[model samples]
Target: MSHDNSAENPKNIDRANNAVSWDNSIRLFLQQAGSSSPTPGGGSVAAIVAALGASMTSMVGNLSQGDKFAAIHERIAEIIGRMNRLTGEYEQLLHADISSFNAYLEALKLPKNTEEEKTLRRAALHEAALHAIEVPLRLMESCRDGLAEAASIAEECNKNVISDLGIGVILFEAAAQSALLTVEINLASFKDEERKRSFEQKVSALTQEIGELKIRALEVTRKRIAGDMA
Candidate 1:
């Protein structure tokens, strides 16, 4: 008899559907997310939120194009390209978040009847948990970078869509906070104090920076929308 080993490999797991959450419509994604399954939880939701922020940034960039805005057309084009790429990266992070969590679930199911089996299970769980943390950390980093790009284009994008840039910053802020919570939860599984503290420090700094960027971006957005940017 031949045995299949697909389930043993996290990369081989079926992520074809959930990875592209927007392709099936947000309604369907929300339905599945609200189901009893726990795969597409906070982490996946954060990725979607961040992606929406990037999309909003790109939307503003696209609106800022044309001969009327020829003075900064090249810079706006570059911003649009960067925002589009960030959107794609966030979508990929959705897959990574789901897979990493599922990998932890698989590790949890490993045999623990003997000392050797228990040792192996512990190691697997440790690795899986770290990966889970890494996914959210990456999401937070992407949110920071995306917000920076959004802020950069806030004053330069079309005045008609200035509010959209603020909306993007708000979304990015929420996603970063959500991802931070996920990272904190995963950090609970770590037995090494030094390693865990390192992650804590990193998340703290990221959260602070994200918050500052949100404030700056929103200020620009408000000033532009109110015609107060003298």
Candidate 2:
């Protein structure tokens, strides 16, 4: 049996480490968007926003994990964990966004000299665009849920971390709003009436949900904060 030495190569090791570091840097990059970089763009930014919301929820739960908050800690922790998983899913969605864009780019390069090829390219572009649109739509939904979860925690979590939960709700709201833009932009390119109508309906529904969640979160946070101040 021939032993493969490629895995042991110093350059390969460095490359592997670099990939890991890059993955980790995504979170940092979104945290500091003012800095220049091509990737971790709007989609990644949305993911980071969702992650921040999840992180804040987690912080509140962790702070309340002791006997004082025993009744709610487990439930809050479960919600936080779900949010964290959603955040990770959003990150994966960002990667999918890149792949979806690349597919569209490839489709654009397809030979237009033949009608069959043209049809194929059009189909490819349509599918790719749909994927692009769906990625953000899903993120919007996830962020909307995060906003709701954050609001729930804000209303009932330990007083000390209520502000953090508010921040989480705000981040999720921003993320949802941002993701909705991507969904709308992609939807504009889709030519199918039925599909367009379906997407539009979904967008409308999500928009309403987001608006309601935002209002509810703000109201809860404001009331909690006001009560604390009083």
Candidate 3:
């Protein structure tokens, strides 16, 4: 039985162990991000920001529910559920994005000394790059969805925490835009013209939707804020 070099290599062990993830504290995550290591980079950070936004959306929704909001209590509860789920999903995606990019790095290390080796290496790299592209694209889609959900929260959530909703909107918009940028970076390596074109179209639509949702959420949030102030 042959030992798999990719699995048994000391370098591989180091990388697998070193990759930063959601289980780590914010302090640890930020420390890793600031370190020379590149695994916990843009894609992971984007997922984290988006998750925070979703969590905040859930926070506001849960806080707003009571006799004060009895008329729309159920709707607020539904939004709470959705935001909570999105927060969990985004947290998972944070680890996934880090793994995908690391897989690409591993693909780069495949033996390419001979014709057969070169062909295998090329195929592996192509597959890994596609997976890498997929991670950030999913991140964008998740953030876009979170933004839309957060926008809806402004409509019926507690007026007192309207500022929290507003903050969540900004964070969601930041995550969506940053995740989209990360997708654009990876898209360059996705060589399948047809699928790449399809993905790009989805990105365009997602960006437009994110923009509109942010506009509406902020407008509603500010109006309520002003009304409260006056």
Candidate 4:
């Protein structure tokens, strides 16, 4: 879970160009999720969640850039700034996703024919699962934080952009759900029941929290929109 800020460096034009170009990277990431490959699995999805959160943050910022909401420029700018930081963090998560997958795949190669080998393989699996767990946990945290940003924007952002905030809320909710699924899937593969129970409980708590946030965001957005229409 090492975080690298280099990906966001302005001098790294090549990396920035390729990452934001929106060509095959996202499609490939999604494709790999469906593929037999394990590397781009949960971690990649978590990174995507973070990306989506950042994207929504950007959307809110864009909507805030004009006339009526000018008073809130500082606040919107802060949200955008945080999203920028999270974007870099998400890129690092992408690397983490690959590393965790590779660790699991390598662990799978341990010779299970011998008793000692079986023990090694089990250890590897546990380690791999732990790595896998980190990806979603990080994503859950990012999404939750992003939700707070969205809430702020929804409360104070330009009325014209109210729908965009709603969209951000929905996107954050989706990211949260995606991350939760990843956590559950990885936890299911764990060999220790105690560890599994612990992780499951945390995941359940996250699920409930996300559900509550989703409901609140939706209600706020709806009322805001209705008020505007009225």
Specify the highest-lDDT model's number.
1
Tens digits of per-residue lDDT for model 2 on 1-230? 00112333443233222211225675576454444333445666677677778888778777877787777877877886887687688777767655665565556667889899889978887777778788888888888778777776666688877788888888888888888888777776677889889989998998898888878877777887888432
**Where does candidate 4 have its weakest 10-residue lDDT segment?**
13-22
Q: Pairs clashing in candidate 3? A: none
lDDT of 4 by residue, 84-119 (tens): 887777777677656665566567667899899999
What candidate 3 gets wrong by more than 4 Å, as runs, is 1-17, 228-230
lDDT tens digits by residue: candidate 1, 68-93: 88988988888888988888898888
Sorted by lDDT, highest first, which candidate order results?
1, 3, 2, 4
Per-residue C-alpha lDDT of model 3 across residues 37-69, encoded as one tens digit per residue: 554767778888888898788889889867878
Cα displacement (angstroms), candidate 1, residue 44, comes to 1.3
Each prediction's Cα lDDT score?
Answer: 0.80, 0.71, 0.77, 0.69
- TM-score for all predictions? 0.87, 0.83, 0.88, 0.77
Question: Clashes per prediction?
Answer: 0, 0, 0, 0
Which residue pairs clash in candidate 2? none
Model 3 error, position 150 (Å): 1.5
**In model 2, where do residues sit more than 4 Å from their true spots?**
1-22, 26-38, 228-230
Better of 3 and 4 by TM-score: 3
